[model samples]
Target: ALTTMAKWEGGRAVDARAAETGETPLMAAASAGQLDCCLSLLTAGADPLAVNVDGVGILALVASKVSQGKRSKVRAVVRLALLNAAPQLRVLLLHHEDCGRHISFKPHQESPERISAILAFIAKGATIGLFSAEELLVSTEFDQASKEHLIRCHSEEYISVITQLGEQVANTPVAFTPYYQGFKGLPQAKQKKAEFSDTFFSPGTMAAALRAAGGVVHAVESVLKGHSRTAFVCVRPPGHHAGVDGATAGAPSSGFSIVNNAMIGALHALEGNHGRLCKRVAVVDFDVHHGNGTEEIARAWHAKHRKAGARAASGADESDLFFASIHLADDGAASSIEFYPGTGTRDDLHHNIVNVCVPPMWIGAGAGGRGSVSA
Candidate 1:
């Protein structure tokens, strides 16, 4: 790839390559939204910041010319390409060595397309236009909210952490590695280090994901109020983890989820007054894991702001506030409210939890059972 790519230079096309095209393959790939090709070429020696006679550098062409919404995908491709080729990234955000690396190259704004792909997975249950945004004169998307909420919600310690990740995303995409180290914990320290070195959150690292969550809940409220019937909060950092105190090893959670988007959604589902959230709401947590953070935070929020005599208990009994999850209970027999089963199990959170204590084979006993009522 390197030997074949010796033609382009100094933001201008060389004569022999000029016959092929004024720009190189890398530049062409950007325009075509061939993110993989572009990233590969760039990593292999193509110029990300190179420009030709048309005042079009590879990044510029991608930003201005390529179609919208495909940018993130293109970027995701770009990230993959970077990771696959480079043996090591000294600074995931600042490649002090990319030939096309720019002192004045400037940062690239995230493409809506890339953001949307993440949104699709994160906000699967939300209804886009009607349920969430129909009643209001304006449609509430999380783009701006994402930017705003994160700035407000995250702690300085937390913000600093994610901010660095964002920087890594900005500078050079990290190669995707498995969550575990052969047979151990995730590469969190590396992730955290990159996040800090890169300044990910300061400019809106995890905030965008937060905004989408809050916005989605607001949409849900609109529906419950008979305003809209459906809507979706296309957001990320899918916030279902992050328990009340802080994140720990056992429970499965995104460190980002410490602030939790779903919890925000549940809060907005309720009625609020005096700039405070107040109401009874049900959080249908269908995500694979039990949404402990949402449950934890909602309970806390209720304790502080719920109306006097309005709630059944002094905020402890959340039977009225629906928080249910279709998850395998990890805490063995300790998985109960009394036990506060928020921490993750000391084992592989079961994928299929069979109540082995009492069971028969396919000759089932209840509900959709195939057998007779009596043994």
Candidate 2:
């Protein structure tokens, strides 16, 4: 498979390091303690001496394995390799943090059990040294996303309204109110709580939401600018449900989501392109709930840029973006809120936006019965 991929990449991709971290496969294999595979790669002309931006080498990796415990068989292989290695190969083994990020806003999930689980997972992983401390960044340092970034994917009106509402709720305790008017199945008394309010807000809610959005923007920006190889933004009050302007399907916010983090990040990436705004990008969403808001934002951007001015004479903006979504289906009538914002139907496809709804049988209790995922 490696040979096939190398052939497909014309003999350069195998040795090509990650664009952000400059890590080669040998580094990964050694870090994971695949001794025999590392030896095989060394024999196959893989650069065992190659270092990442951090200057850690394969010998240093062997030291890490020794710290864990080394077997006689591997010791023999290492001895043979060292005997034949260049003078540069005998060097210090320094283990640097990998260019991957794990970010979260624990306060936003709203469920105490979920928060506990997240904390427990982090604590347990750290206790076992699953990853180094430097790599496990707590995202409190990032500022709230600026209005310029927010307005890229949302309306000024919506932003102003949401911000004022957040401030109001932050100052006083209030019950959750429906964001949209004429929301079905609500008593007149309950509907009078407030207008355009979806979920209960508190002093911490806006701060948490801003951090969540800012974290995603930072993650995407870092990866694109070659500062990090991968980043997992574990935020809550999830954004996929909210649409381009935060008012979609008659809901002020979709689900509990007020801001579309994915869309915000996507727009930032698009705007930061080095070219004449012609670089292509893809947004692949696999949330169990469909990312309708993200879809709306992507489609709008694609349509606006599909035909460009003289600046993009290369026509790079045309067919330059794609959005794919996979999620559970809406089984009821199209008009029903049980469909929950009612967007991700099978028929909703374009040259750019692709939506696939998993069949109902493949969804819950009957999931293992028969239907396939493609269904």
Candidate 3:
């Protein structure tokens, strides 16, 4: 009944009283053996905890039909009945993709309130130790491996539109000065700090969404060891469009389709190990999109090295080690985007992207070695 109720879209149910007193149509129909109606009502938001005419629950109503019972017997019977009711409960817990709605208000707000509403719930979960700081940080994984973002895979056109669209759907326009604002729907202090930080893309800027205090960003060391932190560690401006470089589906050819999270994290880790590290590492991508931009970064890294090698031949004592990235991809031509000469990207490439490509299965698809570098 609940499933049927939730699935109903063309027109509402005859007794769709879910909006009134919170008593959904599913709850009303599940009282009897209207199995079809029962399935339908359970599909919608129906309360099984509802009291019957004699103050008995629907569970108790159904439980009465079971075999004979005593104290433990009655208790076990109730548990069995409840456990068997999961099909009806699951519909209420999840909402699937909206193939029907032309537009959804899913990404509607950038204000603190919408964020806070979840935080309030998460805070309760945090107090009980059910959620961690990583869960609360609200940013991408900050992997050193992903620093060398290629511009080609993630085309400039797609990136610009996505960022613009993201802002249109998620940000509020404010000055980058003193970091303060008095918008009615937003907080003054946070808006101020965010406004100011948006101007700077360094270490702790909120624009980059870097939560350096204590976060999953440190998971770069072993994100692949576990399932939860497998996503790339995010560090600011949160590179949404970064890749190895290629053309998407029907879109024109572009750069890498990934942000060099792997490259950035790996380089940072490598530099920490020794000034002179391995000159080669391979990055294999398995994402649905191509990584043209990541390839662009590798190309740039190669160019810089050729120059550095030229300088070294002249006895400048420089070895700007260069590398390569291998992208395994399906074309997403429809989603291809090009990027502007954003300094953030240049800064990333100037510092990282030196490696090779391993066999496929890097991102959680198949079994392959987690990338490594020894001094």
Candidate 4:
């Protein structure tokens, strides 16, 4: 393979497409599970982004083989192409065990389970030479978000309350219950019983929430500073449900959120103390339920910018932030079957806010899933 690759080093042999199928050497190697040949071809300059006659990408071809129980082979080829072939597209995947450690309702430990499963899959790929050790940048130790960072999106009072509650939960042992009645008697909980009703804290809740917020901040910094072109942050205590005052819109509780991580990361990028790292930022939320907290934050941020623009009389009407939330729409006239935190609607559309509501029982087929909606 080396001798042949050497001869085709400067030639188009590696990427030469089949006359009928339009498949390149790299695509063939990936389809046949030829890991060694795939690596050699990649090193010799095979374009992993090449598409076949059916317009199927090389990564898609590799992914299609996973159902055959060839996940290791698929990961090796995909990671090699992503990390090695495309130097300009350097990608980082960041996660930590602490992000998954949080109190949850009985028989519903989705946060920890999801994190463990994802990490296990990535670990399996790493063990099978999916990519070189140097290509994978996993940060096990990262700084926890400070109070200042948390205050960027959340109110100071809210932050103080959550921090105090987290500390109290850390020191005292609270009984686990499906309804979270165990925490109702806490002093802080009594202060805002409704807000903390749905959310529960554990000994590791503070650590996980801090890490989740901090990990996102770090990921943003790494991308903006050119250390990586993109990053995937996998942390729990999901932040979209959290708003400026813990819970926003009509949410009955914090919705299992401690800190608004996404908002914090965006604010840090746009207005961090170091300096303004970005002139414009966009947040796209894709979830079954609406990201009411993110929308609320974006709305407030835009309002602040509008006020600043008006006061300065600079006529700078353009916004520096854009937020889009695609979520399941509430069932009209079906009050009993309404979704959680149901708030997003078509009427919510603004210059910088876009709410794409997917109706219940809607099935998108083929390229129909790529349908677009005006902001």
TM-score of each: 0.38, 0.61, 0.28, 0.66
* Root-mean-square deviation per candidate: 22.2, 10.3, 22.2, 8.4
Please give the lDDT score at residue 120 for candidate 4. Answer: 84
Order the candidates by lDDT, highest first — what do you get? 4, 2, 1, 3
Error of 1 at 65 (Å): 54
Global lDDT of model 4: 0.70
Residue by residue across 52-141, what tens digits does model 4's lDDT show? 999886655664545667676676656566566555344577888787677564445445887778878888886896746545667665
Point out where model 4 deviates above 4 Å.
1-89, 125-135, 170-197, 310-318, 334-336, 347-351, 362-375
Q: Judged by lDDT against the true structure, how good is candidate 1?
A: 0.41
Q: Model 2: what TM-score?
A: 0.61
lDDT of 3 by residue, 1-375 (tens): 446436668335533544534444444444332345544444453444454445554443442333454434543444344335532211111111111111212332222243335546756876886633233223333322222222222345533433343344323332322221232223654443442232221111222221321122244333322222233332222222243322222222222111334444433333322232333344444333334344454555455556666542222222333333333331122123222212111122343442222223423344222223422
Best by lDDT: 4
Best by TM-score: 4
Across 33-69, the per-residue lDDT of candidate 2 in tens digits comes to: 6655555555555665577888766555543454435
Note the Cα lDDT for every prediction shown.
Answer: 0.41, 0.56, 0.34, 0.70
- Look at candidate 4 and tell me the lDDT of residue 116: 74
TM-score, candidate number 3:
0.28
